[model samples]
Target: MTLLAGRRVLLVEDESLVAMLAEDMLLDLGCEVVVAMRLDKALAQARTGSFDLAVLDVNLGDTRSYPVADLLFERGTPFLFATGYGRQGLEEAYKAVPVLQKPYQAAPLKHLLTRLLMGEPPTREGTGGGPMPCGCHISREQQPFQVDHCS
Candidate 1:
């Protein structure tokens, strides 16, 4: 059974190729994905879009997506940050949020999403920690998924 079946996901990414790949992965997980390439569009959708969860790129071009994140936070939405800089890239206020390093694999992404959506603690194999804030920050960067743009 797919973990995210019937779940709607808002994917905020600036790079088209990365978005395409992530969308494919999300579809494979049985998730309905809404792609937003720019921060403004993502913000609009974040405020009004009906989605179960969101995956936001930390940086979008010259601007950051913190505003969108703030809106999502206000709405009590669950989200994960996809960034090339890992947890270090995020500001102190956002350190506790789940982070997925760039170039991620399908399996880890799936595991993380499952945990996030199911409200479970992130416990994968040897990794040990108390329940993560929402998701775990996996640092390894995969080769195929590179961050071309911030948003």
Candidate 2:
């Protein structure tokens, strides 16, 4: 439906190439994306953009993305993170948000984001919760969902 087709999003990443690919994938998923390559920029956009969701990198160029996450949380915006170092390496506070490991394709990203955006709780893969294939980026350090796609 067109309602899902034009969902607005805010994307935060420091890498230019990754930013471009992720923007494309979000567009394919029907999101009109706004990008911020730094934490400040992302926070600015997160505060100002007409965003329905966010796809944020866990670490920005020089700062952790927790502040940005806090802003998104305040607005009740759902998000999926794109992390290169995997959930195993993050602080306890950040383990709850869904993650798309680096080198992911579009399909899984869509599945995860859709579930979160639709107000579906992301139960950690082992708790017999939301979606099946057990990609647990929720409530704990997930085992890292890897799809092996370059983009």
Candidate 3:
């Protein structure tokens, strides 16, 4: 919570309900979250300032977030991808960045986000997009999570 207290975050998700819920979660965690429903809007915002980090969906409205990820990478802004598509859905280059799967409980998500912001490498296969390396929270009893909320 304290990790993101004053950090600036850009949230990019096409689905309205999921976007709103994520926004609420960011607020609950005390991070300043900006909502961007599309790639263009989020890119425009990215041009304005150096955001501390970002939470993006792998796919937007007919567009992919990989380009945005490149932009964020160039700017040294660390980001996590929130995708309903699960791990196999991820592109090769981005399999290394952190992933936070859909339907996460607030506390686990918060912990993951905090660790991410602090620059910790992941230890377990994230239910969505993280490389199992640095000791992260992975669900032992479950297969990967899938979120079709947007579908």
Candidate 4:
């Protein structure tokens, strides 16, 4: 069985290509994906959306997505930060949250999501003695409307 089966995920990313890649990966993992490409839309969804977990981009254009993160935290929802600048890009308040650096591959992404949503540790073999990489940060692309889907 897939690791993330039946889990719902809220993916907040400003970059279109990155969002699409994430969506595809999440689908492959058997999780439902809800996408928001801007801070306002993401915040609205964060306030009202039902999700098992969230993947938050540290920055949404010129604005930070911390408000959304705060909302998710208040809702008791688990989340992680996706940043191009790595953990250094996050504010001190969120330092303990997991961070997925840019240019990551599928294995680490799946591993992290599985760990977060399922409370399972990533396999130790070949994990490089640290947090696994997950495809998060990528170059920007044209904006797309919000979407929610599962495979």
Q: Pick the candidate with the highest TM-score.
A: 1
Residue 52, model 1, lDDT = 83
The lDDT of each candidate is: 0.75, 0.70, 0.70, 0.71
Instruction: Give lDDT tens digits, candidate 3, residues 108-149.
Output: 557556756666433223435444343334444442443211
Better of 2 and 3 by TM-score: 3
Model 3: which residue pairs collide? 122-134, 123-133, 123-134, 123-135
lDDT by residue (1-151, candidate 2, tens digit) is: 6334788878888999988998898887788889899887888888878788788888786688888887876677877778877777566665666777876567667766766655644333334443323333443233244532212
What's each prediction's clash count?
4, 0, 4, 0
Rank candidates by lDDT, best first.
Answer: 1, 4, 3, 2
- What TM-score does prediction 3 earn? 0.77
TM-scores vs. true structure, each candidate: 0.79, 0.76, 0.77, 0.76
| Worst window of 10 by summed lDDT in candidate 2 | 142-151
Tens digit per residue, CA lDDT, model 1, 39-149: 989999998899888888999999888888888767767777888898789776676567788875687567667767766322322334433542334343533443221
Q: Higher-TM-score candidate among 1 and 3?
A: 1
